[model samples]
Target: MQITLIAIGKTDRAELEELISIYAKRLQHYIKFEFRIIPDIKNSKNLSEAQQKEKEGELILAQLQPTDTLILLDEKGKQYTSMDFADFLQKKMNSGIKNLVLVIGGPYGFSEAVYAECSGKISLSKMTFSHQMVRLFLVEQIYRGFTILRNEPYHHQ
Candidate 1:
């Protein structure tokens, strides 16, 4: 199955963008991967946290297909080890999912509506990282997961 990473806004930092692109390119060898960046909301400074999330949620929802399995990268979501994440991915593919969409929400997090629409959630770490950093981390983990599945030397026990 194909995998799509839906994140809000572009990566402003060149280093982070380059690193994200490196991992993303590496991932293409194993699976169909796409990183969908939703532009930041206009005049976001004037909006409340809830309102921003609501608008971002609308944009995020629009990128999804009816057959896609939506998974949010959330702070409160389940945290899996590299190997376990590979298994999670394997299970999804085995189940015959068409498109697996993983979302990284905006600064204030997701709205109640977005949460309700997701099939599952995954947390990369307990400590918080910048949204830009989260994009890189997620892509690297996906690459690592695939490497582990292939019994590559990239991941060590």
Candidate 2:
């Protein structure tokens, strides 16, 4: 199965982008992976929080295929260990899903519509990180999960 990570906005920090890029490249060795950055909404300063989420949700939904399984990176979602996350990916592959999309919403988070559209949600941690940092964290976790699945030395217990 192919894994796609879509995050709202760009990473301004070069360090964070470089790290995320490295993990993204490593992920390609395990499976088909795509890291997509959805451009931030223009003139968003004039919009309400709910309105911004709605606009971002539209863009996100447009990038998806009908067959794709959507997952949100949400704070309120379930938290899994590295091993469990590996198992989750394995099960998705075993189920023959064509694509698994993990989305990191904008600053205000996902809309009600987006929430309703997703198949599931996952939380990286209880604490919050910058949007740019979240991208790096998610990619590293994905790489670690794949390594754990293969019994590689990359991940430690």
Candidate 3:
């Protein structure tokens, strides 16, 4: 199955971008993975939090196809261990899913519409993290999960 990560805003930090790229490249060896950035909304300063999320949600939803399984990266979502996450991925692939779309929402988080459209949610950790940092962390974890599944030496228990 193809795995796509859709996140709002660009990664402005060069170091973080480089790290995300490294993991993304490594992930290509195991599964079809793509990182698509949804540009930040213009004149966001004037919009209310709800309004911003609504606008961003529109763009996020637009990127999806009918058959894609949408999953949101939400703080209040289910948390999984590294091995468990690998198993989750394995199950999705086994089910013959065409694409698994994981989304990271904007600053104020997702809109009600986006929440309703998602099939599930996942949390990397209980601790808060910058949206840009989450991109790197998620990619690295995905790469690690694949390596663990293949019994590679990249991931240590």
RMSD of each: 0.6, 0.7, 0.6
TM-score of 1: 0.98
Cα error of candidate 3 at position 1, Å: 0.8
TM-score of each: 0.98, 0.98, 0.98
Model 1's number of clashes is 0
Weakest ten-residue segment in model 3 by summed lDDT: 140-149
Local error of candidate 2 at residue 147 (angstroms): 0.6
Q: Please report the candidate that would top lDDT against the real structure.
A: 1
Candidate lDDT scores, in order, read: 0.96, 0.95, 0.95
Our tally of clashes for model 2 stands at 0
Clashing pairs in 2: none
Q: List the residue pairs that clash in candidate 3.
A: none
lDDT of 3 at 52: 100
Off by over 4 Å in 1: none
In candidate 1, position 107 carries an lDDT of 94
Model 2 lDDT, residue 40, Cα: 92
